[model samples]
Target chain A: MIGAERVGAAAAEPSEAIRLEGVRKAFGGDEVLRGIDLSVATHEVICLIGASGSGKSTMLRCVNLLEPVDGGRILLWGEDITSPAVDVNAVRRQIGIVFQSFNLFPHMSVLRNVTLAPIRVLRMSRREADVRADELLGRFGLADKRDDYPDRLSGGQQQRVAIVRALAMQPRIMLLDEVTSALDPELVAEVLNVIRELAQAGMTMLIATHEMGFARDIASRVCFLDQGVILEQGPPQRIFTEPREERTRRFLQSIIEAGRM
Target chain B: MLGGGRAVVVSTVSTIVFFGLIAAAFLFAPGSAQVRQEFFNLHDMKVALVGDPSHGVFSVGEAFLRNIEMFLIGEVLILALALLIAVVRQLRGPVFFPLRLVAIAYTDFFRGVPLILVIYTIGFGIPALGLRVVSTQSAEVYGLAALVLSYSAYVSEVYRAGIESVHESQTAAARSLGLSQWQALRFVVLPQAVRRVIPPLLNDFISLQKDTALVAILGTVIEANRAAQIYSSYAFNYSSFVLAALMFLVLTVPLARFTDHLIARDRRRRQAGGGR
Candidate 1:
């Protein structure tokens, strides 16, 4: 199944969207991402699954250039974004990232939050940005919340607004770092539904998620990270079902026992 | 649980008793009568407040206008200058090292020296230079400049604290959406940071308002404090000083209360889990 999926992926999109080659990152003395190499094709939805502190979010952050890599290079659409000459702001423009905590600008209304990057970074006129933001917000069932502050919204609503804010940039790819993790259990489904809608719309995404079931349903490929490396990866069907790495099985067992899957 | 009405009654009674005892202690103290005669004379206070200008006594009320003018101008300059310094200090990388160094030195020098010394230096020392443009400025200008310089250092630190208090994740989120560092600071980080620090900023402004009195040391400014000093010396009574103190309290007490209100609102907002 993994082999067939790769063959089809290559045929559909001949170019890679994001490629990480031996990416390494450390915070203080702790090396979070020892060496990671992964390639994501256009329109591909790759889910990174791992335990806490396994460097899933770090990998996503490094891809977005939010965290500078200690070693190696990251290429976005065949251009080496990690090169010294590459402008980080310009590089970040092509990729949008939604965070776990939904770090919306608390001081801004939802419309302003969504329109900020489009106006400032993209240089879109305020009116144009507002129209784009409104469309995105309306699509995500957040149209009524356009003038509301993030604090006025529910956790799920804020996360959805965050997604709309990222989408307003019209980024080539989106990185979701446990976007639903901060939501209440009841609120989680609303945020997850938004991601599912994005997936259906064929938005290229690299998602760091704890939802094993969601990963099995939405991801083209699932990468299980262990101790700062991609320990195992395959089509989600194969990775979730087959006996491969003992660590992967143990991780799955714990999730199953915890009734999360 | 204490009943609501009973709790209010208890607190009101306790407050009155607490203050009444302190008042009685001062009233019955040795030489209280002498102190009252000198400092609390209603006639002297009225004379100082409604000054007999024909008799060469500057009205404390009229002279207080100068303090207000100094405070208004100095407060505006200090806010602008301090924010600039705070933003400069926030600049990163090797290229900004020199600018950052200058900002650090400025805050250190001003904060280390007393405000009065700065006033003395800027007021007298600048005139000594005999530089045509600067030397010709009024005593009020020199005094106001000193207040701005000194208070800016303290207020810049407050702004810096606000900037630093904003979580790093806010910056990350902004940057990831393709905002430059400055754009992030201007739009995302600063608005939240400034909102968070407003209570403290108002607290600093209250101090700045009171410190406006310090300009009287220039001798030529003739602000409320100077007027009070002159009146006290002439009448051999300190009641004029009490009137000056009341003037300061009239301005600062409301400001202090406003600051408290801001702090309470901020606390309530946070406790209610984030709102404007």
Candidate 2:
């Protein structure tokens, strides 16, 4: 496809951690991600806030190459990852993702869950992986749960373990897909606290979230996605308090009325 | 006191009637004479225990041992072949389409053909061809091969169902972690799938165990059923068949109960919030 060649002709943007150009994705006839352009700079936390089915999650997924784009190129540090020539696993190694459901490997112990990709894919020795896993678990207050299965942990603890699992790979960027969405209200803060720490530590992150206050606090930029397009994007203050588009205004109004913002 | 006493009397009368009818049938029924003699006579039971000497060389114990040997060999092959076929069927992407189609055809052909016919062909036909290696093997080997061939088709279907039952989200989660599709299956999907279908897999094993009786048709190996056939033909008493039936029950009933116990235990664990 010319998609790959066109991406090569585009000049490299070294400062961008991730770049999506005219990214289009569809599930059969239903186009989920229409033409979109977004750039995430190094160590910048970009929060995607929109209603369900607005393609916020899809965009994050595309960045990690979890979902292939139909017509666009996603560049990871200036390499065209969406090209057919790219080794997906190599690209994915630089980008870690955590899901909403806390999709921890249920059959593995908490320690193994964190160490699996490292030990298997990254070829880290078992002893080294265990040490790294223990350190991450200890830092997240999950040290006591190292031997426990995913089901044994509380929702908040499971989410933290999931984040640890992704972090063990030492990826360049982290994609958090509504990480707190599956958790109970009280459990949300524990997970948000972990993300807050990661942001404070200057980890590059692309987060899809409904946690408005979190977006306000953490995001360098907030992008409002509506029907597979970015309707407006700017500093969190501008997007949240002074949205440029009517659709963005109505969405924020509903969120405010629902006491969610 | 009279109302309570009447209920007690009714229960006692029902128990007595049930046992009374069983006793009367065993003691006085016309056709029961042969059943009584064949099932319980001390003389016939002694002969059945040793098997009829003129028609077969083995005792019933030896026959039972042969059955056990075949089951052990056949079961191992069945498990391996079934899993191989299941994996083949589960192959995805266009590159594997031909192999997948072949696996589909293999299951359909074997599942549709009668197990007895498969045994007859492989048991007799393969040796009749007089080729090298396979032809030189004993009819008993052929019988075991046929058992594996037929049972693998059934077991592979069971494995397929188990694999399919695993949620797509699990695969997605695995893929999101940068695991290859095969790695995802090996580490995440198959374990859960296999756990979910243990009861059904055991059910298929039970059927495979019973079907081992068909091997007697080869006439080259005298297993439990073959011993019963020899005894029934030579001794003119069906007690040997009854003995064989009891032996199968002795093997299968406990397995069935064990499956039930496992299902109950799994349910309890899930209810206790150990669910994944």
Candidate 3:
């Protein structure tokens, strides 16, 4: 449903869904994302796998304009989003992000959480939003939990509800930042399965995750980051099995040694 | 049966000891009867409390009624004004720098100024200047305004604490959803912040109710303490003041109990994870 209204000039330049040119971010003296360049094509799934603090989350945040980049530009549908003059809220409407902690509005019911942006930002009729929300909840096996608050749901159910919330926005792209990292080992699969279903539906997404096996199974492209740079990136098969960079190999080797992959 | 009889004897002895000490202090101590005749005249006390229409211009009861009136007005205004102050204090961008400074200055000025001084300045000083807008209003309005101004500073600080206590991740999540800064604050942050501060806010309101007596200093409004002053001066006894104290206690005790219940409920809800 996204980009449905764009019938004119801008729709023609839909080559890159999101492109980062020399993006750099820092906190105080610590550099988080440094001169990184990446492009996500329409319907492409890119998974960023790396050690903690390697800038994967920072990159996703920058693309959403959640974090101000210290340098460089981010282009969303060929528009420079990093420019100070850009309307951030308008740009953010196209990209929905889910955090590791499943930050559902604890005060709101699951249905309200899913329907809020549509009703408020998009100015959609409540009836329409509710219809869409009910469909999403039913598909996600959360229909019974619709009236329940976030705290009343399990971690996996909450995460699924959060994903459904993003889907209700009909966003062009979704950024998932280690969405399963905070879940218990047993609960991780339930959330990962939802992400897999989204990937199957050909949704464009940029995911930062520690689940190497799941990344290999679903990613169209896998990027292995070291420090603040993407040290190696390629088809998931090659990156996971025959990595070209030493850092990538060593990282995967550590993962293998830790028995996480 | 033997143990129960022993417990009853112990309880009766304790009660006798407590009452005996109180009677000795109030009725039978050396010079206590004369003291009582002067300050504990039951007939005079009743007349001052409810007021003798024939005897005084304003009875302690009328004064107490005025105090409650001021308190009710102050309570509603303080909530809105304090929340505005707290949000202004939290403004982050360079554009709001001047507003931020003004908010900080306001809190500092009001928090530092004594309540009575604020009542005097706004209550008496404003009226004396004969400003068309405010001068025509009664002193009670000015007194209510002073209480609101003074209490908002304290209440704002309490609100600020609640706002800061919400984790940064909450704001990030709200913003990530495309909610604007003010919208996020209104729909997400402030609701939680306000909930967390309700008990403390009620505590501040209790103090606000007590401070209403200070409004009597404006001289135009005869609140309960002022009635006590008038009656004591006439009778040459402090019994009227004692009567006024009883009246204030009558007003405050139920509020104190309610505050305690709210605080305890808040604690229990927190312990049980009230879906914070």
Candidate 4:
């Protein structure tokens, strides 16, 4: 059920799916993500919300070790996944990421985009990869698009296909970097519907989205990041209804007004 | 200025056509000249230089064409083999850089000098080493080696350029799809690059054909330009030079047109991209 009530006002909640400790990252002289601490637990969909340059996307990327952190540690299932000796590629295979731009390989069919990682990295046979890819496509309501190229699909369809591609990896957790932000208003619902299903299935997901409804309805906890720091973290009702920080309240109000339209 | 340009065009065309017709008529003439003399009379006092085959001839005939074909085909085969080997080495990661360096030095040294010098050095000078490029150990084989070595250098660079022009992005996308760097380069990049380089490759081939003439200075056993000069000298008739020039044109002109067609197709693709 889509919750209409204010979320930031909800009571305190505690669980951890992912944990970060003093995770610091800098690019050249400009720091993107400062020292940060966070925790997420199994079957908990955490939505990261913040203004531009808040480094919400950077935090999600670091979870997969796609971008190495300069300082600090990241733990996946309490395993120090950030260690240099860890097979980073093997770790990345277990955690899937979907980009905001829907970076589906343009040259391949939707099925190919989905099945490639499994066959190549995981050493799954083509037949098995194809079967899993088709099932995931069907799950996302994109089965009809299995033979189609990304360019041939609509924005909504492409986004669904991108989700299906990540799910085809059978990832333990999915990091969505503003999946619906690029969609037309009418098309956003279709993509959100697919995500809602994933959340219902108890898949661990860290979503960076401006869609407050998804954050409220799907995420067990919402953390508001501002300027590379978490402003406030709590249940959706607590963050939305009774945010501790003035920054969180103002940010929620801006998005609430936008969300109503 | 326009009238002057028109006059230059008309006169040039007229001169070409006039000479072209004269050369064609020589082919249909009744009296065929044969190269006849004692085969080994060159070192003896028995032969006159202009009177017989031991020295040279006036009529350009089937024998000359046959000899030219033998020399050029030998050279083409050698160059083709060298290019194939270079390409395979380049495809392999540890690009035979030392061999490439030596090949480049050989090409530069040969291409930089007059072709005649290389021919003479190979045919006359290299015998001093008691080494031969061919099992036959013939001087003509040495001359053929010079032609092949020079053409191989130019052709290798053509192949290298074609391989590099393929878009780097195409390679990257392939890598992201789980292809190794080598697989991506081989399956994606080189195919496109080869298509782009077809025109220049043909240009090198045509140039290689023309360069075969340089072997004449070595007095090789099977050589077209040498036949022309030899025949012209023996009969005291200079028209065999005209016949040899026609033979070269017959080979190059059609190839040039085919290359131009490839270039036009590449240009169309570029324009389509720009328009898009």
State in Å the error of residue A104, model 1: 1.0
Q: Which stretches of candidate 3 lie over 4 Å from their true place?
A: A1-13, B1-28, B273-276
Spell out the clash pairs found in candidate 2: none
Off by over 4 Å in 1: A1-14, B1-37
lDDT (10s digit) by residue, model 4, range A1-261: 112111221223233557899888887887878877988776788999888689998898788775689999998877788998887666666677887777766556888878877787678999999988877787678889899877778889988988887776667678899999888889999999988888877677899998887788878899999877777899998787789998888887887777642
lDDT score of residue A108 within candidate 3: 86
Please state the CAPRI-style docking class of candidate 1.
medium
Considering only N, C-alpha and C atoms within 3 Å, which residue pairs clash in candidate 1? none
Steric overlap count per candidate: 0, 0, 0, 22
Q: Per-residue lDDT tens digits of candidate 1, residues A74-103?
A: 999889999889999998888989999999
TM-score of predicted structure 1: 0.92
Fold similarity of candidate 2's chain A to the true chain A, as a TM-score: 0.94
Model 2 lDDT, full chain set: 0.86
Q: Which ten contiguous residues of candidate 3 chain B have the minimum total lDDT?
A: B49-58
Give the top-scoring candidate (DockQ): 1
lDDT of 2 by residue, B1-276 (tens): 469989899989999999999999778888788786766665654676775566553466568777778888988898889988998888788999999998899999999999999999998898889898979898778888988999999999998998998878777777777778888888888888788888888888788778888999999778888887777676677777777888888988888999888899989988897756
Q: lDDT of model 3 at residue A46?
A: 97
DockQ of each: 0.65, 0.55, 0.61, 0.13
Clashes of 1: 0
Q: Arrange candidates by lDDT, highest first: which order?
A: 1, 3, 2, 4
* Residue A141 of model 1, lDDT score: 95
TM-score of each: 0.92, 0.93, 0.93, 0.61
